[model samples]
Target: MSHVHRDRKKLLTRVRRIGGQVAALERALQGEADCSDVLVQIAAAKGAMQALMIEVLKGHLNEHVVAGKTEAVRAREAEAIMQLLGRYAR
Candidate 1:
């Protein structure tokens, strides 16, 4: 629990950074950036988003969902998160 608490901050920070990057990308697009430039920003935003999910999912699995024998609960959480991640991954 203590360990889990510690790592959550980093995960949150990463996600917030990604959110900021997304906002920046939005602003860039609104400013009529070139097509290739917009695409580059979008690809970067997608990568950041993917990284955020990966960090959070791995943390949860390492700390909460996989630390005990709550098979049903872990399964539920894992399935839900993985489903959401699956869409993002594609």
Candidate 2:
């Protein structure tokens, strides 16, 4: 899990930023901000979340798919991740 450990702080920071974006979205909704501005903020939050997912997926692939206890386990892990990615892709 070194991939994840090495980037823990960075990932946490990203998550925090996403949280801030969500809070901003909430405030904008409360204050009745312009539709375009609110949509942009929503897009920002969605992009941040997608980035986080990519990071975690990379770590999982490196740690579990590439370094599992056995070939069978690794294949299973990789297949599971691939299935999730397939769904995400759509």
User: Judged by TM-score, which candidate is best?
Assistant: 2
Provide TM-scores for the models: 0.70, 0.84
RMSD of candidates 1 onward, in order? 2.8, 2.0
Model 1: per-residue lDDT, tens digit, 1-90? 544477878877887888888888898889988888888888988888778767766777776667746988888877877787788767
Cα error, candidate 2, residue 69 (Å): 3.3
Residue lDDT tens for model 2, 1-90: 377788989999999999999999999999979999999999999999999998889888888988899999999998999899899989
Q: List runs of model 2 lying over 4 Å from the truth.
A: 1-6, 86-90
The list of candidate 1 runs beyond 4 A from truth reads 2-4, 70-90
Candidate 2 lDDT score relative to the true structure: 0.93
